[model samples]
Target: MQTHFNSEYPSVEHLRAKAKSRMPAFAYEYLASGCFTEVNLARNTSDIRQVQLQPWYLRDFDGADQTTELFGETYDAPFGVAPVGLQGLMWPNSCQYLAQAAVDHNLQFTLSTVSTASIEDIGQITNGRFWFQLYHPAEEELRDKLLDRAWEAGCRTLVMLADTPTFAYRPKEIRNGLSIPPRMTLRNICQMMMSPAWAMGQLAAGKPEFQTMKNYIPKGLNMKHLGLFMNKTFSGRLTENKIAAIREKWKGNLVVKGVVNPADAEIAVKHGLDGLIVSNHGGRQLDRGQSTIVPMYKLVPEFGGKLKIMIDGGMYSGADIASCLACGADFTFMGRTPMLGVCALGKYGGHHTFEMLKKQLQQVMEQVGCSKVSKLREHLIAESVPV
Candidate 1:
């Protein structure tokens, strides 16, 4: 694929700055802010950056290959887009646009249960080649229906969220009136008007709704009712029984995201899960919790061979990805990084982000004399903090 990357915004920081300028205060805060003081959010990236790598400048080198095999498919890169709810709210049609970009670039994209795009929409866009992350509903009937729809759409991997046991205490969301039953204040409206690109895009896309759950939602309901309905619909806390039930119903690959402890990982393996995404919900759910990387040093060693030990949280660049890989993460995923790309550049933003990440990872591999994705551990020089 020809590079769609913008040289002006070569890094995540640059893209974020551009995104901040283009987006409304509420929208940017929704995408970028975390719960409480955002201690873990900042720590997630800083901790990963602390990991040092040893370069092998003189080693007999074969060219670097970023290709990685997860579950059954080989990807051009080891990282894929992490599932983000209400993607369209940040940038109109972002959920749909990212799906198309992932298809073009041969990378994986996971659609959140509450994401603005429907399961069928992403299924059609990726041609049945996407992952569905279920935010387990309160009703068993609802769960079954969602699983059946995903199966019919040709989705193979099902990611059950183990974190987000409750509604987050994000101060930004509260201040922005983005908590359940989102209220559009005059300030929000004025800010949107100020952001011409965002205002125009929202007009074109229409007001963002939960497309996947629209069928279940009653028609003509006000924002307050819709928020109440959504709040009652999802259960949030995932239990062993819920996992077992879903395992029985879902025939394809099953992965549990937001796992940070070996005990939780042991349960995932016992329940016959295919993978574990070591995450703290990108630090959205936890304020004082350990950054996702810290647990990887423990989880990867114990559960590495048993199941695919994937991770997502605070990874901003290829070097951050290399640090996680060196710590034994089988694959990586990012929500804010790719979202920053889309919010910065609109339509081709996803393609550019994927391409940039691949290029950065390629440079890291060549610099460290690591040719394949599987052997990055050899380049691990030292950990920033002991587990």
Candidate 2:
């Protein structure tokens, strides 16, 4: 497939800067800021860069293939777009755009339950090939309803969120009144006024809502009630019983996200989960936790073959993906990187970012004398591994 990269924004930093400028202050802060002091957020990316891959300069090279096999299917690339809630608020139609792009790229796109787009909308876009990340609704009836919708729509891979037991105390969201429908404070309105592109797009696209849960929301409720309703409706904490129940109901691939340690990983394995995503909720939940890269040194050797070991969080560049693979991650995912792409370049932003990553990863593979993505661990630098 021909790539659609714009020479002007070759790297993630360039796309991020452009996105920041084009987006409103509240929206940008929502997308960029982490909880508390953001120690974990910064640590995630910083530690990923610390990992090094040794290059072989004089070996018979057979080029490189980026295709990855996962969950009984082969994907064009190993990495996919991780689920990000409020994606439409960051960039209008970004959720829909990304779903389309992931399909075009032969990659996975996980849709969050709180995302602006509904499950059916994405199902149509991906022809039921997309993955659905359940937020674990409070009621079994509600959860079963959601699972039924997803099944009818064609989602075979269900990602059960295991990290967010409660909403983190993000200072940015608190100050900005970042609810489902943003609080229209004078400051927020002014910020929106400053970015015409974002403002016009939001206006044209209509107000972003939790389209997946729209039917259950009470009618004639104000923003405060809506927020309260949302808080009461979905449960972020996933128990062993919850996992077992889902295991019984959903007859498809089940993955538990936000697992970083052995104890939590044990629960997934006990419940017969198909995979474990070593993530820190993009460092949005815990400020002092270890970077996603730090735990892989332990998780991989213990459960690598038992289940598909995937990862996400603090990944920014193709080299970051390479570092994760070298650290023994079977597959990878990215939240901020791909979202920044859609926010930076609009409709085709996903294409540009995915293409850039493929090219960048391909170059790394060829230069390191690694012929395939699965062989990336062979190039790992023993002394400088992620620890």
Candidate 3:
């Protein structure tokens, strides 16, 4: 698998720096900020980095392969693009670019419920293979309609977000007026003017909107009313009854995202959910919560074979993916890093970031003398590693 990435930006950090330079301050801050003090956000990456893998120096070895299997489908790599809302706001046409890249590279691309691209459009782009993340609308009818739309568009996996019981109080977003129904302040306009590339891209792609939710929203509503409509429309809290209703309605692979507790994992199993993405909303929803890796460490041992356990939050590179695998995650998803890639290089970012992560993961596998993605657990150095 040859990755045609730019040599100058080889690492995700490089991509992040470039993305920051390319995007407006408000957009970059919204993409980068976590809740409150961002303690958990930093911890998600730092704690996962604590996981150590022992390398095998002398062995009869073949080249490493990164193919992974999940939900009866095979992916070229163990990692895929995690869903992010308002993706086009960060980089115009990012949703389409990443979806096409995912299809071309044989990876999963999860489309957020509020993403700039519509469900049907992304489904067409991925040939019905992309996963759709649901925000859980307040009305049962609306929820059922959204599910039906996803199913009709050929989405087989529905990632039900359960972490955002309420939107996090992110200071950066609040200050920038980047919250729901984002305020178009003069300062924001000035900032957008500063980033011509991003501004021009937005001009070409048209204004970023909740394309998936637009049909349900009434026309001619002001931003204030729109915000109120969004607030009333999406009820993030998830109860067992709600899960059961979703299970009855959606006849697809239902994954409960934002699960951190072992008890919740049990509840998911009890409710007949297919998988659990042990996430803390990428550390955006909860500021003081435990790192995603911590819960993953506890959950995998308790329910490894009971249900599929995937993880996301602070995963930045191939080594990070390898770390999660060594810690017993079935598959991994990355959000900000891939978005940063696209923001930095526009059309090239999608394939470049995907290939970069794959290349890095292949290196880790070779270093650990593991050939298959599932065998990454064999390299875990459990004793000396600090969680």
Candidate 2 lDDT by residue in tens digits, 1-387: 777899999999999999999999988988998999899999999999989899999888878999999988889988999999889999999999999999999998899998899999999999998899998999999999999999999999999998888778788777888765778889988999999999899999998988998898887556542236546888768899999999999999999999999999988898899999999999889898899999999999999889999999988888999999999999999989999999999999999999999889988888899988989999998788657
Which ten contiguous residues of candidate 2 have the minimum total lDDT?
A: 221-230
Writing each residue's lDDT as its tens digit, candidate 1 over 1-387 gives 677988998899999999999999988999998999999999999888888888889879979998899889988899998999989889999999899999999999999998999999999999999999998999999999999999999999999998988877888877787732246679887888899999899889988888898899778766542235546888879899999999998999999999999999999999999999999988888899999889988888789999999999899899999999998999999999999999999999999988888889999999889989888988887545436
Off by over 4 Å in 1: 179-182, 223-230, 383-386
After superposing candidate 3, which stretches have Cα over 4 Å from the reference? 1-3, 179-182, 224-230
Clashing pairs in 3: none
Error of 2 at 170 (Å): 0.4
C-alpha TM-score for every candidate: 0.97, 0.97, 0.96
Cα deviation at 239, candidate 1, in Å, is 0.7
Over the stretch 179-211, how does candidate 3's per-residue lDDT look in tens digits?
A: 433567899878888999998998888888889
Candidate No. with top lDDT: 2
Q: Residue 37 of model 3: what lDDT? A: 87
lDDT of each: 0.89, 0.90, 0.87
Flag the better candidate by lDDT, 2 or 3.
Answer: 2
What does candidate 1 score on TM?
0.97
Model 2 segments beyond 4 Å from truth? 224-230
